[model samples]
Target: MGHADLVARLVEAGGLPGEWRSVFERVPRDAFVPDLVWDDDRRPVHRAREPGRWSGLVHRDAPVVTQLDDGAPDGVGYVSSSASMPSIVALMLDELDVAEGMRVLEIGTGTGWNAALLAARLGDGNVTTVEVDPVLAGLARARLARAGFRPAVVAADGMAGWPGHAPYDRVIATAAVRRVPYAWVAQTRPGGRIVTPFGTAFHNGTLLRLDVRDDGTASGRFGGDVGFMWTRSERTPHGSVEERVLPGHDHTESTTDLHPYEPVSDFDAGFAIGLRVPGMLATVVHDGAPADGRFTVYLMDPGSDSWASWRITPRPRGRYRVRQHGPRALFDELAAAYDWWRRIGRPAHDRFGLTVTPDGRQHLWTDTPDRVLDLVPDPGKERAG
Candidate 1:
């Protein structure tokens, strides 16, 4: 019903810890949210026109998309920024383990709600937030100021971090990155914590927590499954490529017993597949009713023109049609990845971890550092042209 009620529920559910309860109550989410906000469905709700609906959406345990395409046409555009869900904010802050008077650096200011919460806990002067878009940064700064909290909000790339406020006790990112930027580790004090959503090009990632070492290396495991917007520099144009694939290119037909949804639908399996098979993107398009159980999964390689499609139909037991073309057999690669995931007993997110060396070599390991996933090229599979 009300924001306070929601916060109490979250605390009872263990989403909000007791230490952060006072801060959450003091920093109202509505003050930081904009007049026009988009719900999870991508539909816009104006506070001026629909105050009731807007208030309900803002207090709910969900993200409200604030800026679309970095504040383009507003109502109808790809989401570029938003106020992160309250539950996730609490979870990440809990993982941050911040204490009063600790200096913190936050990547992606977004709507500035997070900075307000941080400022409430650690004081305004102790928090520095960086945003890539000048417009977004200005808006967040204004919002933070309006909410009676002002942190050092900078309009610059978050990847570089804010070196002027160096040696932060904690660094957290609201965006997703393929690799943990070296600058973040370097700027953080030794033994400090760095938290961010780390994922592959495939778009399935988990929130990673790393402990910065004196040598500037960061290593830790996946804290949990999280979906966040890509860092501006890493964002790429992608979607249904069915039109680009076209007809009469090159294709081979085959059959497989594996269903198309198995790997893509399961969180652990999809993440494992993404890690094992790098540079591959998987998207599934449903046909007719879901009860009809007919869909086509498209897998593509961003580096090449290679693409594959698997057509699945409703059946108790049967072979599914698979069509693939270009230099890489996309389906074959995916199958191999899924097989690897299965062989490892379909480990969950916590079972996986990442290590970023001082030299910038990132390695993904399962359970321990000794058993790392190999991404090396295989000369044995080279095409004999």
Candidate 2:
């Protein structure tokens, strides 16, 4: 599709704004993408001046992986940086409500595409982006400058929120953070908006948009689902699933008499489960043949080294079995959350909201009105070694 068609699709996807469609059409996505990057299939693809192919690739809904293996672009390890998919970036910008002349602070400046767009919307002087990786930051700075857009590009830990330019009108983080940094809340002006993908031990990311209140308490609804690169400081390998014990199972198998398996990506279902069963981590693993597929979901806890596995059989229907085991019975918790979701008529994303206090306390709430659930630890405590 051409630029016009692409922009139209983005609008339909609720990604591009009516006012910003022109900017999307004008800014060359191909310019910001590095020469060497990975495509959707995780295959390395080089960008060349083939107007037909390059334009199509840039317009696709998939994210172009810009940095791999912690900023190593040579495809040596995991994805660390990316020009976030068009829809995801648009969704975040929409939540941010960035307007002309607003001072914006963006964390995780990866390929400079986002920074360029911010510069395009709110003049270069009004935007400041912080990138933790020196190499990535330098490349983004040069790329933005070459594209005729230059924001205050700083190479510093984004967790700190660049105190030199305090009190920003809007603060958005491109990276996923385990805890909402106190610095971000402090730097945002009262009534200003702060948007970020708050990570949990859950299966998906939650898009949090909080309004900074006069007393430093921020509250708002969870806007949508997003997946982002984890902050550098929080990056670590979650030990192999095999090492963790599976609840109620003596060994791995193909079938059992538990909850039937269903293959559907329901964000609300996962979020509700996460909230109901706090501190539980679940990972989805797809296996078996294409025609006869099977899925194994493992739920575990890092603090207790406990876990459970649910196996779904392909009886050409949604049939599955859930087994509980381990010191912390994860399967039982998951089953309880699943039943709760059903009892509540499967609450959607709109019903959920996030409230963050000045002291760095975060709460996830449903519209039905219950006390906010605290997801982070107290700031005063530290690991006792």
Candidate 3:
């Protein structure tokens, strides 16, 4: 598709406002992307080697990985940063609801593509973006300058936010976080908005938009099914399903008629389960080709070194094997959480809401703050914002 065609598709599908049409057209995504980038499948696509493939990936609405394992040469290959998917980026900007000359602060300036878009619309002088990785920050700054956009790109931890430019009209985070930093709410004006991807160890995440109140608290509902990487400071343990979950290890064996269909694959169930069971992560391993439809779902909590596996066979006789080991019964926790979700009428993710207290405590609620979920705050991270 042509640039215009892709922009049109993004605007239409992402529910982007008509005012952003020119901004999307003006900011070219390729300018901020690195020469050596990776696709979602982990295939390395060097722009110099395969210009056509690189251009195709850059032009489309898909996310292009710009860095891996925090740029470590021999790292375990964890995804650290990337340009966000265009459609989701548009949706976030729509939620930001910026106006002419509105000052905005952006957390996690990965490729600077999003910053450039905001700069194009609001002007460089009115935008300031903070990046946790100094290398990424410097690269993004250079890219922004070369592209005729010079938004302030600060090389500092975004969780603390850039308070030097206080009272921003809006704030947006490119990375996902377990908690919305109180610094964001404190830095934003009373009537301003803060948008970020909020998630738990059990799920990749959902987009949360909070309105900062004059009383120094922010409250809002969750929206969209987004899976941005967690901010560096708050990332869950990296992909360690094999290391933690050993099927041969000594474990209590049981049988369950409950399948992985609703609790594992269903987004609504997974999100609610995340709220109930903290510090839990889920991964699916296939017996053979996924087409065979034989697989095992592993639930793990790195904090407690506990793990559970639910096996699925192509032809089931109404029963499946389940094995769990370690101090905490992860399978039981997950099953109980799923049951609670069903008992409460299986609410969609959008029905959930979040409120950040003045002292930086995050509280999850259903429908209204009056109905708060009894979630224990990790003392170590109570002021992490």
Q: What are the lDDT scores of the predictions, listed in order?
A: 0.83, 0.74, 0.87
Candidate 3 regions exceeding 4 Å error are 12-14, 247-249, 377-385
Worst lDDT window (10 residues) for model 2? 376-385
Q: Per-prediction count of colliding residue pairs?
A: 0, 14, 0
Please write out the lDDT profile of model 3 over residues 185-285, one tens digit for every residue. 99999999999998888887899999999999999999889999988888766647878877667899999998898999899999998888877788999
Candidates sorted by lDDT, best first: 3, 1, 2
Task: Tell me the alpha-carbon RMSD of every candidate.
Answer: 3.7, 4.2, 2.4
Better of 1 and 3 by lDDT: 3
Badly placed stretches (over 4 Å) of model 2 are 1-5, 11-14, 48-55, 72-76, 242-265, 285-287, 290-293, 314-326, 368-385
TM-score of each: 0.93, 0.84, 0.94
Per-residue lDDT of 14 in model 1 = 81
TM-score of 1: 0.93
Task: Report the number of the highest-TM-score candidate.
Answer: 3
For residue 24, what is the lDDT in candidate 2?
Answer: 83
